[model samples]
Target: MRLEAVGRRYGARGPWVLRGVDLDVPGGQVLRVEGANGSGKSTVLRILAGIDRPTTGRVSGRPRTAYVPERFPPALPFDAHGYLVHLGRVHGLGGRTAARRAERWLECFGIAGYARTPLAQLSKGTCQKVAVAQALVAEPELLVLDEAWTGLDEDARAVLDDAVRARSAAGGTVVFVDHDPRRLAADTTAAHRVQDARLVPVPPDAAGGPRVVIEATGGGVPPAGLAYEPAAPGTLQVTVPAAESDAVLRRLLAAAPPWHIRSVRPAQPPTEPA
Candidate 1:
């Protein structure tokens, strides 16, 4: 998808939040947006996710999108599972499929026990889990997250990290903004910062590069020509190249017994030679 010379403002005479922004969100990549608080990072995400329209310029190639806003409305009149199921149906799933997927995701986020609990009564962390789950119910082609991890617990945070990786690996585009500088540090294929009411590219060295650490067990040698290190007794830290990661994953999954993938995450960029 592409946003060309896009600009946004609240009212006809209001101040512009974003102006003259040109961005291309390509498939199979992760992009990070950064800016100081009150900057237009959230505005950019909203525009990208189609929640808002630009006052000027044009956006093209819109795909099936799912978004998680920074603020979730937990006072809605639905239970945890019911909300997810409703959202799944809105995303085009059948009733049974939606309910099944809703239950599965609740389990994945460790919130299945609260499936029948009303949304207004859930804790903040649990509500955030529901928010994240709602976004993933449809396996969308474009996933947008604006500080979606703020209230999540450690395990839930890790689950979100894995979901981000899985979406990009499946040839989808993922765009996100997180306050933490190290969030997906090395897995970002592109980085941009909202500056002076515009989007500015951040160089790879400054913003980190597209590198991921794949942790798996079951004792298998690293694929030939792949760079890796031993992360633990039974784990391998396979450093995937930015462009060939999908191919590498395919090979791993095709291996005998399919080396159980424990986790996938951004690998810290290699230190530069002085």
Candidate 2:
């Protein structure tokens, strides 16, 4: 998708939150947006997801998009499962398929037990899972996440990280904004910051690269062509390349005794000399 000279404001005389922004969102890549609070980052994401329209400029080649906003309304009438199923149908899935996918995602996020719980009664973390699950149920071509990980626990955060990787590996585009500086650092294909009501490209070194430390207990020699460092007794940290990460994961999972695949994340970039 492409945005050309895009600008947005609330009213005819309202102050512009975003102006003259030009961006290209290529398929099969992850993009990160950075900015301080109230800096128009959310506005840019809303425009990209078609949740809001630009007051001026043009957007072209938009694909099937799904978005998870920062603040989810937990007061909705339906239960977690019901809401997800409803959204899946809205995304064009059949009733049975939608229910099935909803269940799968709820299970993936470790909230299946609360599937029937009312949205208003669920915890913040669980509600966040529901929000994320609704978006993934459709397997959209473009996924926009604004602070999607804010209320999630450690395991849920890891699940989200894997989901983001899985989406990009399947030739989808994922755009996100989060406060954490290290979020998906190694995996981001491009990074941009909102500045002066405009989008600015961030240098690669500054943005960092995706680096994951995979630890395993029962393992033979680390996979060839991948770098590994000893982390603790009977464990090794293997840094897998971002693009081929999914393949590496599959290999680890399929290995004899499964290599006890531990964690995957962005690698920290090296510091420059003073």
Candidate 3:
């Protein structure tokens, strides 16, 4: 999906919240958007998620989208499971399939016990898990999150982190805005910041200086958002910033069965174009 020169404003004469925003959201990658508070970051996400429309230009090829906004209505009448199933159906899932997926994600987030509890009765942290679960129940083609991890507990947060990677690896486009700079920083395929009412690219090394090369083998289909090249017959090379090397390593080790590390060292200088 792509946003072409998109801009948004509250009223006919209101000042623009976003202007000349051009973004290309590709499949099979995790995209991170950053900006200071009140910098129109949420506006961009809303537009991308189809919650808000742009006053100028257009968004094209948007697929099945699911959004987790900063604030969720806690007083909703339905229980967590029912709400998720409803959203799943809204996203085109059949009744049985939606119910099955709802149960699965609730279990994954450690909230299976609260499946029948009313949204109004759940604790704040538990409600946040519901919010995250609603978006993932149908396996959306585009997942948009705005501080979705803010209220999650440690285990739930880790589950969400893995969920984001899983979504991207399954060929979905995941776009997120989180206050924590380290949240998925290493796994991001691209980063951008909302600035002066415009979206601008952020260099890969902006988060950390220099880069490190990680060579490993036996990890099938490296986690999405990481760039890798086949090395030896059974090995692959992944280059990430030094500061994010640890996070990268953790991701590798966190995978089921894990990866066998062959080496971690400074990346060699890039070769000049002929």
RMSD of each predicted structure: 6.6, 6.6, 2.5
Flag clash pairs in model 1: none
Q: What's the lDDT of the predicted structure labeled candidate 1?
A: 0.86
Ranking by TM-score: 3, 1, 2
lDDT of 2 by residue, 1-274 (tens): 9999999999999898999999999998899999889999999999999999999999999999999998999999999999999999999999999999999999999999999999999999899999999999999999999999999998898888878877887889999999986677546778899988999999865633465656666766554334467888878776755655665665566555567777776777779999
Each model's lDDT comes to 0.86, 0.86, 0.90
Clashing pairs in 2: 185-209, 186-209, 186-210, 187-210, 210-267, 211-265, 211-266, 211-267, 212-265
lDDT of each residue in 1-274, candidate 1, tens digit only: 9999999999989998999999989898889999999999999999999999999999999899999999999999999999999999999999999999999999999999999999999999899999999999888999999999999998998788778877887888899999987677546778999998989999765633577778777746554334467878877777764544565675567565577788888878769999
Quote the lDDT for 60 in model 3.
Answer: 99
lDDT by residue (143-174, candidate 3, tens digit) is 99999999998899889888888888889989
How far does residue 218 in candidate 1 sit from its true spot (Å)? Answer: 11
After TM-score superposition, what is the CA distance of residue 156 in candidate 2 from its true location, in Å?
0.4
Candidate 3 residue runs with Cα over 4 Å from true position:
229-231, 255-257, 266-274
State residue 187's C-alpha deviation in candidate 3, in Å: 2.0
Candidate 1's C-alpha runs over 4 A off are 207-274
Clashing pairs in 3: none
Q: What's the TM-score of every candidate structure? A: 0.79, 0.78, 0.91
lDDT of model 1, residue 11: 93
